[model samples]
Target: MNLNGTAALVTGAGRRIGRVIALALAERGADIIVHCYQSRADAEETAGQVNRLGRRAMVLSADQRDWNAVESLCRQAWDTFGGIEVLVNSAAVYRRTPLGDIAESDWDEMLDTDLKGPFAFARFLGPRMKERGCGKIISISDTAARMIWPGYIPYCVAKAGVDAMTRGLARALAPEVQVNAIAAGTVLWPDGFDAHQQEQALGHVPLRRAGSPADIARAVCFLVEHGDYITGAVLPVDGGRHLEG
Candidate 1:
């Protein structure tokens, strides 16, 4: 759990919270395999930051929604880093789709990206971690999974599935590879939401503040390095926002 010589694969690590998690692992002396979908520039930037930390970093681009892409990503990580000691299922798609507006395509996309993608990635990468007799698998979840967010029905449902998957995988991969989830609260406003929107969102947080990417990253680090006895756990980094009605 020290992570001094471990290698990690962080999915959706190109920007936002994924980027921070990748960097935090690097700071702990772990080499990283950074995965991004469309943000090649941001992925490279994240790699640069990791390299600056004097750790090895490799950027792999893959669409998590594709099973072949997920398999290829695991292969690429092994080829680049020798082997993976940690796997972070951080790449995900979040959106707003009301129940009435949720088309089949929308449901499929969200389910594949948020739930099936993680399952595929973990299935492929799990053997290596098991073979090694040790590993860490962390998935980023959301408060929406536990609370009903009206306009994000699809997203909420997908994340709820992720939470369930995490617990199931943890039970299956126990005593060797630990599987955990971090349910993030109001970490950051979506790319275009303004200050007013941000404030409106924060009103739901019991702490009266939004959490930073670093806060989530730190929780991830704790799971990887110190949570030896923990598995099938869902830790909320939501600033007590889950309490809101």
Candidate 2:
């Protein structure tokens, strides 16, 4: 994909890693549809940045877990841009839910947001892309999807589902729309983590350091701009952390 002037939708684009990815796409000449759940202010700010970069941007709000909202968002994006050539499923909820005390609501929230959101977006937008005969869908996955994280079982399961969804969608949409995922590791330290927890997390990384949002953003750019023949791939932008035991 050339990326220039292509319409791209990035979910959870209001802040953090999602924000950087949105900006990266804008910088590369792609028009952005920035989606946020509650951070309207932040989403607007991101749109402003995209506009300043000389790319068109619009901010939209929707709860990804709501199928009706997801459908409406897809319709709105199509109505606004005429068509969407790229979709980034970056919206997710990450939290530690100890297995011993895990609640139904907790599991549902994590799975619904982290896994079902992407599934819903892809379900709604995929056929349109198929009709057009070209598109790219990039999902945000995590290293924990493939590893054991005792305190975050639900999150891990959801991400693992994301990885599966990426591969399945790739096969299903092949010869037309490309689907792929990025499995990231130790990028941004969650605000909830204490210093000791952060250190312990970092210690597992073979690179012995945390990565930046820009690192993940660059991977997204690569997939968007140059990954024409790549599909069903889970590119690990983890500074080699997935290699650790």
Candidate 3:
């Protein structure tokens, strides 16, 4: 993909999908600023992996829901890396907040973390990229945003807003920075699920299997490394489950 001189900022890079994407971008030759909130150990592990890929890596901690934190995160990333060439908004708060039982705090937190954080980061990063004349900003979305997930209503709504924000930024940042998203299906089984529960869930996937963090990581790399013409696109890495779901 020839990202030899580029720098990338990845949020929630402490573990899981975010960790994998951080490593993938490093492998593709982009220096990385990996962001994490509470998982300092895991964030260090991710940075170690990025360094192993022979790309420069730095770890930054910030709660994505906080505006000051989001602004500072981008500032620190730009300062550490000289500049950011890509921004991946992968930090998110996910939980089953059913419509009926969704508390004010729960709703606010989900919206702020999953939606507002990305918007704020993009707002800060977009102008800088405009000065450089080229950049990419990718956000992570969930299948729940496409189809109603009864108990996960709040998370779904927040992700939907993320989708809308991605498109808006694509238009606003046109001719310079590209904005896009990757909507995932039953990728990693959520933590605490038993083997039987995992199997039951896979039955619904057309591929008869769950995806790995690498699958999602690969999509991000494709967007950042190869999809220059593709803006405002929400590519689904959902194993065709979006069809049935």
- lDDT on C-alpha atoms for all candidate structures: 0.91, 0.93, 0.89
lDDT by residue (tens digit), candidate 3, 47-162: 99998889888999998889898898789889878889899999998877777778999988989999998898899999899788989999999877888688887789899998
- Give candidate 2's error at residue 141 in angstroms: 0.2
The TM-scores, one per candidate, come to 0.97, 0.98, 0.96
Q: Per-residue lDDT for 168-221 in model 1, tens only?
A: 988888779999999999887877898898888888888999899999999999
Off by over 4 Å in 1: none
Model 2 per-residue lDDT tens digits across residues 1-245: 98897999999999999999999999998999999999999999999999999999999999999999999989999889989999998889987799899999999999999999999999989889988989999999998889858899999999999999999999999979999999999888877788898888788888888999999999999998889899999999887888885
By lDDT, the best candidate is 2
Model 1, residue 49: distance off in Å is 1.0
lDDT of 3 at 36: 93
Off by over 4 Å in 3: none
Ranking by TM-score: 2, 1, 3
lDDT of 1: 0.91
- Which pairs of residues have clashing backbones in candidate 2? none
The regions of model 2 sitting more than 4 angstroms off are none
Candidate 2 vs candidate 3: the TM-score winner is 2
